[model samples]
Target chain A: MMKIFGKVAAIVAGSALVATAAFAEDRKSYPAPKDHPLSEIISGYEFRTPETRALQDDDFENPAYILLDLGAELWSTADGAAGKSCASCHGDAAESMKGIGASFPKWSKERNKAITVEQQINICREEQMQADTWKWTKDPNMLGMTIFVKNQSRGMPIVLDNSPEMETVRKLGEEVYYTRYGQLDMSCANCHEDYYGNYIRADMLSQGQINGFPTYRLKWNGVGSTHRRFKGCMKNIRANPFKPQGEEFTALEAYMMYRAVGLPIETPSVRN
Target chain B: MRFAALVLSGVFMASVASAEEIKKVEIVDGAVQASLTGKPGDAVAGAKVFKGRRAGNCLACHGNKDMSGEQFHGETGPIMDGVADRYSTEQLRAIVVNSKKVFGDHTLMPAFYEVDRLSRVAKKFEGKTVLSAQQVEDVVAYLLTLKE
Candidate 1:
C-alpha cells in the first residue's frame, strides 16, 4: 500500500513539473543537436533561398477582402432592433481590439469552461450589439469580420494569461501533442518535436510553428487557415481530427500561440 | 552490375523508343523493379523542388543542397546521390510510386505516385499520384543526370 502511494506521489510530482513547464513561456530553445533526433533533420533540408525568402515576404491581398469590406459596411449599418452597429459598440478593430486574438481560448471560471475566439465574437454581436447571431462557417459576413478584425493586431505578441483556470487546457494541448494516435501509433511530438526535420517519405518536416498561419498551400491549391492545416496534420497521423472550429482546436491554437511567442507572424506563406 | 545495367537500359530503350516496351519489360508486382530509364532527367527543375518550397520538399528531410552543413541531412533514405546507378528508371519509378512495395511492406517513403496521383502511373494510380506525366518524366530526366 505504501509503494502504491509512493507511485501516485511520483506521478503527481511529474505532472507538476510538466505544468510548471507549460507556464514557463519559452521552452529550451529548439532542441540542441545530439540531444534530439530532429537536430539532424534540419541539416538535411535545403535551406530557403532569396527567391523563397521573397515568397515568404510577398504581399497577399486577402481574396476575401471584398467580403471584409461588406462586413465593415454591415458593421456600420444597423440590422437589429437595438439599432446599434458593431462599430458602435467595439469602435475601431485596430484601436479597440488590441491583444484580443492572443488572449483567446481562455477559460471562464464564472461560466465554468473555456471559450473560443469564434464564440466570443458572436457573444458580442448577440448580447452587446443586439444583432442576430451570425451563422457559423458559410457566413461570409462573419468570416470577413473576424479576419479583418484579427489582422488589426497582426504583429501583437500572443499573451495568454497563465492563470490557474488555464492549467487544464494547457495540459490537454500538451497531451494531444505527445500522444501518438492512428494505425501508425505516431504522435505529434514524434513527427514535429521528435522527428522534426526528418523525412517520413520524401517531404521535409517543418518546424510546425503556427506563426505562418493562414498560409497558402500549393498542395491544397489555395490559402487555408491554421486550424485547417492543423487538422490536416492530425489526419496525416491517421487520427480522427477534431473540427477546425471546435473547442479542442481553440485550445490547441492557444497553446501554439503560447509556444511561438517570439516568432514573427508569417501570414499567407506559400507552402508545399 | 553491367548485366543489370544492360537489362535496365535495354528495358528503358524499348520503353522510350517504342511504346510497346511494356511487353519487353517484365511487370512483376510484389517485387520492386529498379529499371533505369537511360534518358537523362532535368536537374534544373529537380533542383528547384529539391531546394525550393514548392514541392519534393527533399530539403525538409535529407541534406542535399551544397554549401551548408546546417545539419538537416535526413538519414531516412540513403543519401539520394547516384540513385540512377543503383536502380533503373522503372525501378526508381516503383520506389517513387510506392517504396514499401520493395523496401518492405512497412516503409517510410511517401508514395509520391500513389498519394499525390502522379500522372502516367500504373493501373493502381488510376486516381492518385503527385507528379504530372511530364513532371515524372522530368524527375526521371533529372535522375539520369546524377552521375559521379
Candidate 2:
C-alpha cells in the first residue's frame, strides 16, 4: 500500500543523493610527507586512462555500487547467534563509522598484531555478534561490508600509527618489499619503486599504493581486497604468495599504509 | 676393463641428458669465455624471441631505439640501443646468462638462466629457467646486432 510505496521512494531518493554526492566530489591530489622515499607519491588513478577514472567519479556509473548497496542492506539485517545487526549497535553508519577507513591496519592490543579493516570486521562478527566469520577474500559479503565501511571515510586523509611498535612492523614490511622472490627474482621495489612511471609491455606501472584498495578493477570485472592484489602480484612473479590476513601481509599493509600517509581514502575506486 | 666401459657409457649418457639441461657456464671477471650450446645462434630467430611475450619479453623492460616498429617499449631498465658498443661478445654472454653475477644482486635485470638461488618459485616453473641455453645464445646474438 501507500506505506510500502513510500519506503521504496525513500530508498530510490537516498541512492540518488549518494550518486549525486559522488559526482560533485572533486578528485584531490596530496603530496607525500617530506621524508618519504619517493619525492612525490602518485595515486594509481593518475596512471589509469581517463575513461577508467571517469567510472570512479560517478557513483551511479560505478559498478561497485551494486555491492555497496547490498552492504547497506546487510547492515540492518540481523543474522547472528545474538541476533544483533551492525545497525543495532552502530546505529546510522554515517555517524558511527565515519573516518574509520583511513585509520586501519591498526595495532590490536588483544590480538597482539596489526589488523586490517577486513580483519576488524571479522573480529566484530565473531566476538560481538557470535557470527561465523566470512572467508577473507572470496566472500562477497566481506567485500561489500568492507567497501561500505571504507566509503564512509572517503576524502579523509590516512592517519598512521608512528609508534615504536609500528616501526618494527614497518621495518619488516620494508624488508619484504626489498627482498627478491621467485624464479623471476623480482622485488616489489623492482617494478613499483624503480619503474613507477614506465611501461611493462602495454601496462603502465604505478607506485603500488593501497589507498584506493578494495578497488573496482575492470580487468577483474569486480572489487578485490589489497591482500588479494598482493597475492596476485606474488603469483605473477612466480612466488608462493603468503596467505591473506597472515602476519606478513598485515605487516606489509601497515608499511604500505604508512607509505600512503596523507592520501585520501578512495575505497571502491575504479582501476584497470 | 668392464668397469671402465661402464664408466664411459655413464659419461656418454650424462652428456646426452645435459643437452636438455641448463648449460653450465663459468663467470670469469664478468665474461663467459665459452659458448653455451657449442654452436652459433641465428640472429633472425633471436629477434622474434626478444619480441615474443612468451619468450625473452625483453621489450617489456629495455627500450631499444633501433626497434621503432615494436609498440610500447619499456624504460624500466637501461635502453638496449647501441648495446654492442658498450660490451664485448663474452661479456654479453655472461650478462645474458646471469646479470646478477656481473652487476651484483641489486641489478633489476633477472638472471635469465640461473635458478639455484631463486626462492618460492611457482610449482610449474620450479627447476625451470626463463630461457634455454640456445635461447640465451640467440638473445646474446640479437643484442650484438644493436650497434651504435
Candidate 3:
C-alpha cells in the first residue's frame, strides 16, 4: 500500500533538507515538499462548513459503520482463556469505563514506562482479555474494538494522573518530544513548536491538539482513530513505523496527550 | 378499542425509553462541560481555544495570522459556521484523531493515535506514540460546542 510517489518524494525531500541544512543556515530556507505532501496542518482539524467539511457519513449503510458495530460487539464479548469479556472485568463498560478514554498514555510503575490507552487495552487483552495481540493495521476486530472503546469517553475532559511514581515516564515523554528524529531531522517542536505558525506548503501551522480525532474524512472515506494519525506522522517523518503495541509509542502517547493538557476532546470529527 | 389502547401505550413507552438514553450523556461538570449553554457550542471558548497558541490553536493555519475580530477566520479550511448541525460530536472526534483512516490520499491530515508510530530514534521510539485517546475526546467535546 506504499505509494511509489510517496517513497520517491520522501527520498527527494529527505536528502534535500540535509543538503540545504548543511549549506543554507545563513540563508534561512523553507524545507521542500520532499515527502508525502509536506503539510503544516493535518486537514482533519481544520474548521470547515457542514457541506465543505465533507464526509462519507451520509451513507448510514456505509461499510465504515460496521467497524463501530464490531467494536460494540467486542466490547462485551469474553476473550480470555478464563472466558472473560472486557465487560466481565470492567463491569459494564458504560458505567465503569465512563471517561476512561480521556485519561491515557499513563505512566506505569510496574512496567517502568509510559503506556498508551491502546497498549493498556492490548495488555488487558493478552493478560486479562486472553485474546492474541492484534496484528499491526490488519485486524479489523481489534482496530474496530479499540476505536469503539475510545469513542465511549468522547466528551470527557482529559484527566491523566501525574503521581511522583510516574516521574520517569513523564521525563521520557518529554525527551522524545524534544529529541530530533526522522530523516527530516525535525522534532515535534520543530513544526508544532518553534515554527508553529509558519507554512509548510499551502497549509498553515497549528499547535496540534489531540482533542478532535478518530475524525471522519472524505479522503479516507470514514472515521479513523488517533493511532492511525500517529502512523501518518511517522511516515511523514520518514521513520520506520513501529508495531501497534510497541513500548516507545506508549511513552510518546503520554507526552503528546499530557502536553495537550486542558484541551477538550474531539472523538469523531469530520474533516475535508 | 384494543388497537387504540396498544398504540397509546407504544407511544408512551417509546418516549420514556428515549428520555433515559439522553441521561447517559454527561453535561453537568459545571459551565466547563459546554453541553448546556448558549448556542450549540460556546463560541467564546471555540474562539479562545481555536485562537490560543497552546489550546486548540486553530488560528495557526486557516485564518490570517492576526487573532483579532470574529472575521479573522481560517482560510486554508472553510470558515467555521454551524458545526453542530454538520456532524455530531462523535463524528468529529474520529477525524481529529486520524483523518487518513477516512480521507485517502489527503495531503493535509495525519494519524494522531499511534502517538509515536514512527521510530524517531533507532530503537528508542520503537514503541512510541503521538497522542493519547483522551486528548482526542476532549477536543471533540470542545468542537461540538462550535454551533451557532
Candidate 4:
C-alpha cells in the first residue's frame, strides 16, 4: 500500500510540472539550402494514391477533362457588346498560352496587388472578351476556363517573378502562412512545413503545394481553385474563412505558388 | 534528452499541486485523478468521442490497432497499440485533459480541455474548453482498453 501511494504521488507530481511550464512557440523557417533552393520543395502530387495518380495521367479518364473541354468551347464563343472571343486577340491557345499559367499570380501594376489567374481571366473578360466576369465561387465556366488555361502549362515548371515592387506583398503572404489562427491555434506551416510527411489521420499531408491549382479532389467531387482549397483548410481549423477571391486569399495563393517554385504545374491534378 | 531532464527536474510536484488547486479535477503526486462518474468510464461511449471529428479527433494523428479498419487513421504521432501498458490511468487522464502536460506545449495534439494560452480563438468559443470534463474521462477510459 505504501509503494502504491508512492507511485500515485509521482504521477501527480509529473502532471503538475507539465501544466505549469512556459508554452514554447518555436516556429521553424524554410530549410532552403544555399546551393539548390528548389531541391527542398516536395509537391503533394508525389504523395497521391496510385489510383488518383493514374486518373490524372490520362486526360480521357480524368473527370476534370470535362471542364477542360467546356473551357475550349468557351474560348471560341464570342461574348459581350464587342462579340470578341479570347481566341480573337490571341489565336490558338496552344500557341498563345503555353507558359502563361506557369508565371501567374504575378504583380499587376493597375490592380496594385498580386493577381491570380482567375482575376486575370476576369480582367480579360471585361477588357478583351467584353463578357461579364464569371462568378467567383463554384462557377462552372470559371473552373472550366481555369483548368483549360492551367492545363496548357502542364509539365512546365512554376516560375512566378519576384519583382522588387512585389516584395511587400510576398512578405505579407509569408506572414499569413506562418501566423497561427483559429481555435486550434494552428498555422499553415504547422501542417505543411513541420508535419509535411506525417498523416493527419488517413490523409498523408503534402507540403500544401499549389502547383496543381484548380485541382480535382475526390473529396471535393469537382475542380476547385487554390483559393477554394485555402478556404476549406481554414474552415477545417474552425477559423472564419475570408471571401474566396478576396485580397487575403489571393495573397495566400501568391505565397503558395512562390513556395512551389520549380514544381511542375499539374493543374486539374487528382487528390483524395 | 529533454524528456529525461524534465523527469529529473524537481518542478513536477510543485506544478501538479498548483494545477490541482485551480482545476475541477484532482491530482495526486503527479497524476490526474479525474473521474466524471466517480467510476470507470463506459468504453462504448468513449470510442465515439475518440473518433469524433469535432471532439477528440484522435484518429486525425493517431493510428489505433482496434481502429485499423476505419478509414484515414493517421501516423503523425505514436500509434495507440498497447498504449494501456505504456501509461497509467491517471497519466492518460492528464494527457487527455492537456497533452502539453505530458508531451510539451509544442506537440501537434491540442489540449482537449485547456482553455488558456490559445490565441485567435473565435469569440463564441472564448473560455470554453475543447471537450467537456466527461468527454475527457471517456477518452481516457477508451485509451485504457487499448492493451497489447
* CAPRI grade of model 1: incorrect
Q: Report the candidate with higher lDDT, 1 versus 2.
A: 2
| Structure candidate 2, residue pairs in collision | none
TM-score of the candidate numbered 1?
Answer: 0.52
**Deviating ranges (above 4 Å) for candidate 4:** A1-39, B1-40, B68-72, B88-90, B115-128
What are the per-model DockQ values? Answer: 0.07, 0.32, 0.06, 0.27
DockQ (model 1, Cα): 0.07
Best by TM-score: 2
Worst 10 residues of 4 chain B by lDDT: B13-22
Q: In model 3, which regions exceed 4 Å deviation?
A: A1-65, A136-138, A195-199, A202-204, A221-225, A241-243, B1-148
lDDT of 1 by residue, A8-112 (tens): 346544654564344233233333234332332221112233454455554444344455465567767776667887778777766876665555667867657
Each candidate's chain A: what TM-score?
0.69, 0.87, 0.69, 0.85
TM-score of chain B of each: 0.54, 0.85, 0.47, 0.77
Query: What lDDT tens digits, residue by residue, belong to model 1 across residues B1-148?
Result: 9999977875564344323221122325533344334444566765644544334545554444341544455534445565566566666665554555555443344554433322222342234333433444556556656554
Q: Where does candidate 1 stray beyond 4 Å?
A: A1-56, A60-81, A129-139, A198-202, A266-272, B1-148
Candidate 4 lDDT, tens digit per residue, A55-162? 988888988888889999998989987899888988899889888788877888987878878888899999986789998768989999888888889989877676
- In model 1, chain B matches the true chain B with a TM-score of 0.54
Give the lDDT of residue A24 in candidate 1: 31
Estimate the TM-score of every prediction: 0.52, 0.86, 0.50, 0.78
lDDT per residue as tens, model 2, B13-99: 434533467767799888898888889977887787788776678898878887789898975666777878777888888888888
Candidate 2 vs 4: which has more lDDT: 2
Best-fitting candidate, measured by lDDT? 2
- Error at B145, model 4, angstroms: 3.7
- Kindly list the per-residue Cα lDDT of model 2 for residues A173-224, writing each as its tens digit: 8888888888889999988876665678788888898888788889898889
